[model samples]
Target: MKTANKPRTSGSGTKRNGAAANGKKMPDVNGPAGDGKRPSLYANVIKQFDKAADMMRLDGNIRKILASTMNEIIVNFPVKMDDGRIEIFRGYRVQHNDVLGPFKGGLRYHPAVNIDEVRALATWMTWKSAIAEIPYGGAKGGIQIDPSRQKYSINELERITRRFTFALGNNIGPEYDIPAPDVNTNPQIMAWIMDTYLQMMPPHERQRCIHVVTGKPIKSGGSLGRDKATGQGVVYLIERWAEEQGFDLDGSTYIVQGFGNVGSWAARLMKPHGAKMVAVEDVAGALYNPEGIDPDDLIAYAKEHSDIFGYPDAKPIDHMAFMGTKADIFIPAALESQITALTAPMLKVRLVAEGANGPTDPDGDRILLERGIHLIPDILCNSGGVIVSYFEWLQNKRSEFWDLDEVDAKLKKKIVSAYERVQGVAHHYKTDWRNAAYIVALTRLENVYKERGIFP
Candidate 1:
């Protein structure tokens, strides 16, 4: 078992060192422009935390600790390509805090992966776990390579994943830090990570470490509802909101930004509610159909065509027009800083449910607040994935498997409880939902810190 407060070393015997090694420098967070007109992703995260901390009067010491990551693990590992060439790839695993429990989050693979983005996501994971009242802290990992853009063959992808896992070594463990699926990652990738991690352990210990990563294939110890957890969580919150407002979901129109796992699942799940998806957007293009585009059809087409660009039922629509489309609900499940100040004004939705982390910047948040557009913040809205991941981890630890119905019921209960807590905090403090969520999480962590005083 790993010792508390002890940093895990990589396979190379180095601990938490990567940025400055080998004459490589960490990128300037302020980008090339450096005009300060746009803040870096991590900067925006700190701003949010500061706002909630000031409002809640968080403890100075704890605030200082939470303001920065506890561990930033960077590794530059080499992977062999299909063309008989070796390429060096940089990977990151940022552990923000573990005051609540073990560090828990997802591993994403994207071209834009950077320390700032990973740090921001890791910080959010800590808040997400606290808000959900789960016994997990926060962490996030990523490899700086676009799985699609790089055109890596399956063999190359598997090799890269295994090499990255081997590099992570003890830094990730079933009880220390567990990774699940995020952007451009899925069960197959998770299986590779788990296998690679298991192979690094003794034969007897390997069996106990099947859950070194969550979101694996069910046969590989993944949970039944794990795949749809985040989207299901999003829909659950939306359902609760609709019930509270006495709004009929039947025949309501909605738009989705990003047709990936979360967006597609959320859209498909909303079908039973009789809701219609009128518009959808992704990295490639946008689609619109006032009569409603079928989620099942779009997803199937996307699976085959690799995008939602040419679905016959929906006509091509520009981003501006798509955002301006009349709808009762808008789900931004795409990249960070998507719904900025410029795009926020174009949204004609009654609600903005963030499925992606940091989809709204400070300026966009102000616009939404000013426009009275209700929002279910990313921390609370997209927490189902982690909640179900917790369930999976528990199951693996105990050698048990739950059916889909059981998983869904448990997820609903946990997320709804969190929602109620946020709602109560919002009502009590008379604040926005985002601020209310942070307050709830910060209050929980603050109490924990008070109870378990810091060790010398």
Candidate 2:
């Protein structure tokens, strides 16, 4: 519990910009490269913050507060595997800020998990909630093992999750730090967190603590539209951007990277609106079918094969080809720094909708801007999940449940409002969308801090 504020370093011991500084090979983003020292995803986040902070002339005190995390919790928990081996897994929870309310973020399961990355993610969650006008902050936690390769049995995973939860202890609560699901994690995992946390609580408090974690199974006090919230948000922002830019979605083609939760859902939703997914690259492989790939078929293959490795309907494409493929729009839903200086130039789309957190580094972002590619920053682009998570939290607190239609409708309204606000700010400041987004969030936070003043 006391490990909540320990600053984490990337395993490689390289600075955020150090990887490139050391002449490391920059290639396609393989979902957060996990070699020795992983690049500072947290550094990328702070770079964005510093750029915006300087431009906005933010108060130095609040700027410092916003620059660092509020707490970072690291846990070394033991779990008995199905193989009868007791293994220890390292986990983390980085709470960025709670100036508005509770800290909310996702708990992921990935080999690339580290203090720097989670800290970056938690920081983004703070700005994201602020931009969405939600009364929540940011936090992120995950273990540093590849779930895909580990093949942990359900019982094994449940044990690992429960033990991790027990170790987290009172660091998480309904009105404190609430974590949802992230990469390789799902609603089922969220349920495990809820169940474990409740079991650890006082008998009288168990029933009222469902809000301790969100993105749970619908029957488990989860919101109806939570599963597709992030993807839906990505497309929502894209659709609005299209409307403003006079780009028609009906006949436009898009390329998506990381065909997992966000990419697959966005493709499926966009298909009904007549958009085409001409290319997709995932961990399994890359596929290109310029004639338009069927989302249903691809989704089915991914579900069965665990990756879209060899779908019969589409031809395999290399990562280079995947990035270089010409299309109307491109969505990077994979991991941070995917759109680096090398890959960014390969992108041939007029617009980029970032469905993943910090998909484009500042350098990649600069190139995209220079190339005249419109971008919807991750904070604004993939905020549908948190917005709906906020809804679920409110629902659980109020003992009210909403239907799918109601949930979707509210999500759309919130995203659209946020989109318009960011656009307005960008236009007024004559700045890029990424900077404008930060400006929007910072303004809200600044106003709050300015009005309330810092506590004694």
Candidate 3:
């Protein structure tokens, strides 16, 4: 598949200075802010990219092209609420790169959604696709609305999603750009977007456009294992890490931050391997049980109560206590910048497998590195969703369906292969796994640019 080559204005000059192109003085990566003010997400992502690019001596032209997004689209559309009120919603879609193939990412609905966050997510998607060896680039988008709030009913959400899709129009397409479920989004939301996009096309074109958005309900063309793909991928990489270290997963204890789809699924899957969940945290509150909490029970409670705060099997604990809970592994499936200078020193785990994008800031990374903590970077660790989304896309495009066993088998193969590649690069460079993952991704992107060259 091919997309129209869109020229983006270069954000970087020929000079390879450490400072950002926007004139903000670059902070010392080793030492983050002491005042606890986290840097911009986009700046942090750029710092990671620059480190890999410099380490590998990436081509200057490719560096310049990737320094900024190829397209930053913001749409403000009005939606009529169920209460007979018209509310204007702001949405964003940032296409970071498309050198590999079509743009692919997720659409999230949260009040905190902003341009910088969207850009950072889009940039991460680029690395994730490259790391997974998928034929896709990166793009992320979201609307500034709190889906969890009770003010917006289901009907309101559908209208808002449909109107946002209408506003995006051709910016998203089956072969050009595809959106999937992200934070505060589910298969139902994706189905709305897919239906909205299809309605915009004629009957003949509608059939071909079902692949425009993935993570839909299975009846609506979603893959069998799409819901748990990210969590399963995280567990797969963790299993590989255990094998390399000669550590047994059976009887190991783990703690998870964020009891969302990724966290819950990971906990449940790891249970079959004899791993135990000692603590779980979410937006509502945190829960701890030294004797091990049952993931199945906790998930059911969370579904009914909206979070894992009041699970009867576990006691309520504060965030600091949750972090300090001693466990064999820590899975941060929450928002970005959660583990910074303040929180990094509190983690009691030996390994951190990032289930969410950009969970660790640079300072946190340095602290973990200094403390001899092992990490499975988010780009490589949480890539199962996108990898399977690619499968769902293929299925839709070919009018074929895959069973759960087939999807799970294919996902494991791709994720394990990517994990091995990252491990190999880490060994070759003698760098931390995070940096090695970035290098692996950048190497692929750099080589593609070298072979393809810039268009005339």
Candidate 4:
């Protein structure tokens, strides 16, 4: 698959420092206060890219490609609410790169969705796939409709998804752009997209196109072990890191910030490793227990109680308190920017593993590095989703499926290997983990671009 290449131009030559060419404005990104408000998400992303580019002494041309997204689509559409009122929703999709292959990422739904967030996320996806050594580029889409506010029935959501999919037209395809699940979206949502795409295609061409969307239900051709892939991958990386550090998992305490799919599954996986989960925080509330909460029991309780609070055997705690709780490892499995400078200094953990994209802001990350916290960068740490999504896409295209055990084994091997590689890069660069990860990904992307060369 190929996309039209856009010519690169130097953006304000006066800002032509190695980092500046990467489109990062240091003064604008020094902190959330630099702008008198939170730093722009896209700016924060570019700042990191710039830091990495500066470290690598990357050429301007490659920096340009890495710094900017290849394509961005915005759509405004109306959906009939349950009250029979038509509500307008804004949606966005960003394809960051296609140098490796087609763009692959997830679609999110939230009231806070915007073009800047999508672009930043798409750029992260590009780095993520590159870091994982996956044969794919990066893209992301989101609709700015609060799923909670949508009192519409399932039919309305399906209609909204189909309409948005149609607006994408040829922009998204099995061989062009593929989207899975992200914030406020899930496999059911993906299935809606696939069904809509299939309905739009000629009947005979449908079978060849089912691979266009991933993260579907297993009955709908989703890959086995897909649901737990991301969390399991985190555990896999933790084990590898533990082995390298000569730390025992048994009796080690962990605190997970966010009791969502990634956090819950990670907690469950750690249970079998003999690791104790000391605290877990969710949108509703948080719970803590120094003796360790049994994940199985906690999960059951959360399901029954509708939140983490009020669960028997665990004391209810404030959200901020969970951040400062002492633990061997801390996993931010929640939204981006949750671990800002204000929160980082309070974290009493030695190891920080990101289960969400950009969970640590630039200032927060610097503070963590200063304090000698070993952070598993999000790109490498949470890449199991894309890796397994790649497998699911391949299976759909080939009409073959692997069993759960096979999928688990492959996911473990891939994540563990990537972890080792990133660890080596960190040591070689004598830098913190996030910068080390960026170095590894930038090197791979640069080599590919150099070999491919520019085309007329």
Candidate 5:
């Protein structure tokens, strides 16, 4: 696959004193460049790879190959709108690696989706799966259309998905690139992709193609406990951490940012564990009550009202205040960059469990570290989704479905075991969890790469 040239600013805008620009100095992955200030996603991914490579003393050739995506497909397809107009949408699917198995990751639907962002996400998936000891690689796809805008009808979305899937062709398969649900995408969307793939396959091929996609509804061969898998996994990690620290969750408090699938389910699971759901926030707004809000009641209310703002049981709070609220645990399940340096120090919590990818900026992470708050990094905390997605893929390939209880048990074991491994590394290295996790994952990837060696 041909790699796109890295974007460069010409003339005096370039920095001369920085590390060599000829791939000698690894790019700054965390530097701000977006909006001309935050670093681009591609730069961030490269920066991370460079850091891990340096620490592991990786070979130059392997570093370059691992740093660059193996495949990136950009699609500019036209979809007919409800008003009889053809709207051209930009979509991207990036496969970072397939060394372990077929690439696996989520397909997000949002206006902010970009090639750089998808590439970064796919790269992260590679590390995440490796860290979790899963037999998968990394790939990510996204349509740059905002689902909130009713510009496209359901039929149009289906058409777009089918076209994108078909465009992928042999690039994706039951043992190739498997796309699951991500931000703004759900089981229904996965079902659409599966149906579309089946429609294009022969009868015998269809049977083998069911594993091509995961996160489908259970009735459609999806895993039974997949819906709440990520959230449950987060709760499991929190419980393990609490036990390690001797913190009882019975009367503990939590502030959750994001009321979507992960956040909502996390609140519900933690509630039954005796944790008080004091604050829940989403794009609509935030709701808070020091005495504790019932997750069951809040979920029902949000279902009916579409937002947590008008819930009579809790007082409405500003989004900023929600972050600074006092709680035992604070979960950023909304989106990346929600927790920053400004918000990190203000958090009156003992732990920050990331439910979203890259939720904390580098600066914010430093602040949280200075304050002695334990951070259960995104790679370890939010791995449940992918873990169950792996299970779903396995069942699809074997044509054997497990019960909900079985799935849940397996997920909890995997997540808790991964958490303990991360914690052990943190203690052994005497470093924060994030660095410890990066070390652990980097070590695993490096070892595997060495074992496999180079293919001449």
Candidate 6:
């Protein structure tokens, strides 16, 4: 548990902390550029939207509408700390667009989390839901405090979460902005949100409002396979891509950046296909093993040491070396803007399946395109988490639970169909996959407005 009030980020904006084997500084992949100005994630998202809109020659009015956020909710509430100190915490909920359906996204807990990042994520959620053919728009919110470095205990965190939920009040609901787990947040935190929201409602409403938030524990109305859905989705896409490109996963090597829930599950799920994860990198440091490290071993090490920076079983390597490793695939399951213009050229992978939202910046995407790297857009690649989240919401609303296999099977079908649709759209437009994905989403929204027309 983290101490409360004093906030810090989880290795975000981290500089070149590791030196290369030749003793030169490793370029900071996810931090401020040479001018010390951090790249704007929201701006990057807009750039993608603009490019797609241009390709489609979309109407100016619709383009402007899709390019902007629909609603922005910011709140500041005081939480009584364990030491009886009242510490004010800032929170934000950005509902990008709900034209398709109710707003849906995640609630992240990180000190580095801000309105812009949340807005970008919310916007991406809109595209993701559309690409996956899910009836959801987009919204993302989070409290601005690092879960790891915070001074709050479990009880204090619960109080703060409930108070935050209380502050949002009617802004969230079963058919409205549904929040799920994001970085530094998990099922337990979601359970707290669910319980708090339920307590505030009337008896009949309380029983029906559990869908106010998805990603809760199973007992709390969460779906069976929601935990591994995102990672499983990544592997499913990789399998289909491998088949399309005639690339064999057997005896093939890949590199995973970030060994959290997404990266770890990706490795474990891919091992059965004989795919080898040769390198792993996280905030602690990077690890390399050409012989292939066991996914279970790595998971156990991370559990025991709280990280995988210096696991004795693998050779520790630098950031540049990890990026430059010989691999068939590179999964950036870490943070936004991790692969910048500088580090983009160092990639040796044939495919980049974005496991994290906005992992590749606009500049990086341009470089990858010029280099002919098969870049799977984050919106489509990471739609599984939200898709499974939709399943959880559906289960709660219908008062029916799905089995693990049923959830996984449904997620795979939805994501694979999305991948095929994106490929066909890209081919038809003569554009890249990222732009194609945006077009798919924008076109859907455009049709909605065209038929319904803007209200007074």
lDDT of 3 at 388: 95
Report the lDDT tens digits of candidate 5 across residue range 245-338. Answer: 9999999999999998899999999988889989989888999899999988989998998878789999998978888899999988988888
**TM-score to true structure, per model:** 0.87, 0.85, 0.86, 0.87, 0.87, 0.87
Quick one: how many clashes does candidate 4 have?
Answer: 0
- Compose the digit string of candidate 1's lDDT tens values, residues 411-434: 999999999999999999999999
Best by lDDT: 1
lDDT of 3: 0.87
Model 6 C-alpha lDDT versus the unseen true structure: 0.85
Ten-residue region with minimum lDDT total, candidate 3: 1-10
In model 1, where do residues sit more than 4 Å from their true spots?
1-40, 78-89, 110-112, 146-153
> What's the lDDT of the predicted structure labeled candidate 5?
0.82
Candidate 5 to truth, TM:
0.87
After best superposition, candidate 5 residue 278: deviation in angstroms?
2.2
Clashing pairs in 5: 29-44, 32-37, 32-38, 32-39, 33-37, 33-38, 33-39, 34-38
lDDT, candidate 6, 398-454, per-residue tens: 999888888988998999999999999999999899999988888888989888888
lDDT of each: 0.89, 0.86, 0.87, 0.84, 0.82, 0.85
